[model samples]
Target: MAHIVGGIFTSHVPAIGGAIARGLQEDPYWKPFFDGFHPIHRWLAAARPDVAVLFYNDHGLNFFLDTMPTFAVGAAAEYHNADEGWGLPVMKPFPGAEALSWHIIEHLVASEFDITTCQKMAVDHALTVPLALSWPGADNRPVRIVPIALNTVQHPLPSPSRCLALGRAVHDALASWPGAERIVIFGTGGLSHQLDGERAGFINKDYDRFCLDHLGPEPEALVAHSAVDIVELAGSQGIEILNWIAARGALGPDVREVSRNYHIPISNTAAATMLLETPATLSKAA
Candidate 1:
């Protein structure tokens, strides 16, 4: 049966795409963030998952404000990147795992999650930047992708508890699939940074540190805060943590942190990278 290999979580700051375009990995300001990926590359090298089930939020590329779905899944054969007017170069398309995407769609619906299924979706930096960070260089991405976009862009957004449950349902779906593929979960976006409002350019490092510390062992700790509470503390755009929370749910319980990097002010966000997985013995024993 198909099994989850691990989950990779990171901030999908737009400037990351620009940094890549300008070859700024070693630049003093970008160095700390870029260096975080070196260990992620090493982990991916060792884990070798065949497919990635990505959890991210769309940024007006595929879904606009008026037509956004709370949750959407991609069933396309390939996903292309487009210009979001952010001046970031378009990334090469990522091949999709269509069958697996459909299977996940079916399972989510059966579990009562009401997810929108997209046959053609244009991925933006949120999805592409993480792939670039995990597998740098041309033709380097070795896994098929299954994109799952959450509604972080709009208000009346799903709660942290709900997203967590959605992820758990996805975990169950992967477990029931009869394929032999090894899957990795990608959760993109945010530690703590706000883009607009009176608190514009706001970031809460202490809260971010609390989240990073408990995401694995005590995710419910995060769920205790209301959506309004998150906005008050982490900023408006910081609601992107919903993506990370959902990805954590898909990982199930007892995950070991392989490596983590946290740095502040990565283009208006507190950038973070964390690689988590179930213990090898536990995975095998299951």
Candidate 2:
């Protein structure tokens, strides 16, 4: 059976992509955020995940307000990244784990998640940025991917609790898969920051810290707040934390935080990165 290595959560702010494109890692403004990934790089080098299951929100690149599924899973052979006009360069195509993708799609449907299936999908910064951050190189990344997109661009987003359940269903699917591949789950986007409205540029450091502290050990505590409450407290876009919540659910009940870094005002977003794996995995690695 396939083995789930662990989960990695991070903020997928577009500006980080531009910083990489321009080689601005050492720049004072971007240095702190870029530096945070060094430990993640070391961990990936050791863990070497074969496939990445990304839980991310599309930003009008693949889905629009007129029509967007609450959840969509990619089953493509290859996933392409297009320029989203955010001053971020287009990224090389990411290879897809087609068999794994289909398996997850089937399992999700069987589990009554009512998710949309995409034979072809164009990924945006939400998916690409995390990949680039984790595997920084000019060539295509070594690992294949299965992109799972949740609707956060429009109203009626999936509740935090529902996303958590979706993650649990995915965990079950992976558990039943027969492949020997090692998998890593990625939950990308937000600590907190709003881009528009009178409360534009809003960020709640206290809330962000609260989430970072509890997401690994007490993920259920986060779902206690309704989706609306998340928006009001974390900001509208901060609802992206739902991605993190879902990723946490897939880790089973034994999670250990390996590393975490938090920095403020990364494009007005409270950027964060966390690495979590089973305590057994950590002990074995030790």
Candidate 3:
């Protein structure tokens, strides 16, 4: 049986992927952080999991506020990349692993996760763009995907504890599977930056670090934090740390950081990536 490798966190800021591609690392503002994620490239290479259960929230593209589900898993054969104002660069399209997906969905519900599954739906740029940027090429090849989309666009989104519970259920579901040997779970979203209103430019380095601290090996702290508290600190609509908490909760305690990177530019968002490994060594911390 394969081990449930664990989770990763990253920002899906569109423009930044292009910036990094254009050698933004040379900019004094971004270099140290780019250096921070370089280790991820290395970690990814070594782990080489058979599948990646990716979690990403759409920016009102795929799941609109009209009829939103708390969480949806893609059981589609192929996902089209739609433009979100800016035309997304076409990369390889990922064909989800239906077998694994069905198993996960079945077990998640049995565990009371209640995830929505889509047989066919066009995957928006929110997921593909960041995934492509993170791992160029090799779609559904080295790492088969089971795409999970969260409904963070709508207000009164799943409560922090609810999201965390779902994550714990996800871990249980994955562990129950007897076939898959190596799996990588990813939770993609924000860390303290707002994109609208007068508070748009806010960036909280302290909060970001605090989140990473509590996420790994101790998510109870975040569970104790109120939604209002997170919104106030991270911004009104920036309370998506719940997504990260979900991913962390699934991984449970006894985790170690493989890599961490943080960067903030003119855009009203902070980009960060954290890689957690299960049964990780004590020295892996940054």
Number of the predicted model whose TM-score against the real structure is largest = 2
**Residue pairs in clash, model 2:** none
lDDT of 1 by residue, 1-286 (tens): 8879889999999899889888999999999999999988987787788999999999999899999999999999999999999899877889999999999999999999998999999999998899989998846769999999999878898999999999999999998999999899999999898888888899999999888999888989989987778988899999999999999999877798878899988988999999888775246646
Clashes of each: 0, 0, 1
What clash pairs does model 1 have? none
What TM-score does candidate 1 reach?
0.97
Worst ten in a row by lDDT for model 1: 277-286
Query: Which of candidates 1 and 3 is the stronger one according to lDDT?
Result: 1
Q: Model 3, poorest ten-residue lDDT window?
A: 277-286
Candidate 3 structure quality by residue, lDDT tens digits, 34-140:
56666776777776677778777877666787889988888766666666765445555676667878887898878777778888766665566446545654243
Question: How well does each candidate superpose onto the true structure, as a TM-score?
Answer: 0.97, 0.98, 0.89
Cα lDDT for residue 217, candidate 3? 67
Q: How would the candidate models be sorted by lDDT, starting from the highest?
A: 2, 1, 3
Model 1 segments beyond 4 Å from truth? 281-286
Candidate number with the higher TM-score (2 or 3): 2
Return whichever of 1 and 2 wins on TM-score. 2
